[model samples]
Target: MTNTQIVIAELPSDSLTPAHFKQTTADMPVAGDGQVLLKVILMSIDAANRSWMKGATYRAAVNAGDAMPTYAICEVVESNSDRLAVGDIAASEATWSNFVVADAHKCEKLPKVPQLSNLMSVYGIAGKTAYHGLISVGQPVAGETVLVSAAAGSVGGYVGQIAKALGCRVVGIAGGAEKCKWVTEELGFDACIDYRAPGMSKALRAACPDGVDVYFDNVGGTVLEAALFAMNEKGRIVCCGAVSQYDTETPTGPRNLPGLVVVKRLRMEGFIVMDWTQNDAKALRALQTWVDAGQIKVTEDIVDGLENAPQALIGLLAGENKGKRMVRVAADPS
Candidate 1:
């Protein structure tokens, strides 16, 4: 069998489109020594995927003619090492392909869940990111006002919910009225401001009457600037992904940078989820407990078929997805 793959046909100078990617077939890969062949089950479609194309951030740059890279949940159909065996489910850094050969040592074996898609959502990068970025970086205390941007998207939604469970008053900033409503009503945030509406700064200040003690910023354009103006003294800013700037040719920085941060004594920090690898077990346990107790509600936006991965990412960047967005490549083994 041949492996179907999506490669970067051309790097986007501005906005990304389906024309930037090309689908092609290649010979099925063989598992070499200490490697395993994986059948991709789910591929995470994140804003980071677009940022990687601009240049390297935490990882290597995605050049033209290279298969688009992704974080994937896969099944080990062939193994050459003791780290994983055939039929084991694993999570790995994979490319946009039907089959991949990865070093067994790099693949993480995952526990079985009723819905394998959960492995790509709550139990995966999205939930872990929210848990670590909010609790560790944001360091919000009970009764304090916590504000999060992109509240309707993957990590931001979880950030708001996790803060609510911690007894902190939560507010969200999203693009539209519907999304803002979902953030407050469904995700349990105390209030949500539609950033697309007029007088965003005023609305944010009104929602966060106590002033924002912790600002979990996911989109880092105007929303971040607004949050900065509303921060209280000694507040913390968790710099997650910058979704607003990812899909454009020109990216703008938050206007009120070190000024607001310095005046408020705000602690601003940026992190990749991998930075807190040592705390994965603790984070996972907390997330699982919250999920079991119904304290954290999980939402997933899944697109079927590997060919639609490009559109999935484009839509995600356009604020079309409501929660954790992923592309389904294949069905779970029955």
Candidate 2:
């Protein structure tokens, strides 16, 4: 009868909070010609969601009075195109609503998995991002030391594991001691440094005595500066998300920019997961094999209900989540 939606009530000028979002109801959307009606099942909660509000990077800016944009896993309930049929599962660019209309050509038809959430986690954006960013851009070699920031978070955790599977010594930089312990003991990283602790440079030096051959940076500010200093000559730096500066009013950059980059001859490259669309199938196959072999562990932090999406993003930006965070909008079609 009606569709529940979460829209940006007001754009945040500083740190984001739940107050910035509002819940409302709208008439159910209908499938049009060459489009499909989708019942949203799972919505991804990412740090980029916060960054999108500030301004456009790879996509348009999220302005006030607009439905929050997200990549969602949905089930087609009504189809107006030959590309999809009723009960088909799809992944598409959708809003924070229980139901939506998406172009049939743009929606990706997904296979039915035992757990649909896997389509949002390991087999989805998190795993693919880590795979593409590391393999394509980082170009890590065997026996090298791979360092990743925000190691306990979604993408960073997988980056370290994938590097380890490739016979590289993996080290992580997380926020607290507990997260650092999890990164080392559970995720199979050789070492994990607590960036919040004092003497971070010394601790990083101690952890990476051989120097870092590759750095997968997620949180940009000081952690990036620290990793820059520890980088080996000709090391590769994969610039992923900048979680540290996403939700702030005044964001700072890593002061050791071109100077350290030029001196070390480090190959630093930034990328979005969409950049490797041609190799998505290849990456997914490799990820599935690694999952089957137990080389990469999938961790998901899911919150129930669409109304909780705002708090989920806020918590994620505050470094409270341990893995890929997502919101369950509706039950999977059984």
lDDT by residue for model 2 (70-135), tens: 999999999999999999999999999999999999999999999999988899999999999999
Superposing all C-alpha atoms, what RMSD in Å does each candidate have to the true structure?
Answer: 1.0, 0.9
CA shift at 132, candidate 1, in angstroms? 0.5
Instruction: Report the lDDT tens digits of candidate 1 across residue range 1-334.
Output: 9999999999999999999999999999999999999999999999999999999888899999999999999999999999999999999999999999999999999987888888777888999999999989989889999999889898988898889899999999898998988888899888999989999999988898889899998899888888888999999999998988998888898876878888889899999899998998999999889989999999999999999999999899988899999999999877
Task: Give the TM-score of each candidate.
Answer: 0.98, 0.98
In model 1, residue pairs whose N, Cα or C atoms come closer than 3 Å (at least 3 residues apart or on different chains), thus clashing, are none
Q: What C-alpha lDDT does candidate 1 achieve relative to the native structure? A: 0.92
The lDDT per prediction is 0.92, 0.94
What is the TM-score (0 to 1) of candidate 2? 0.98
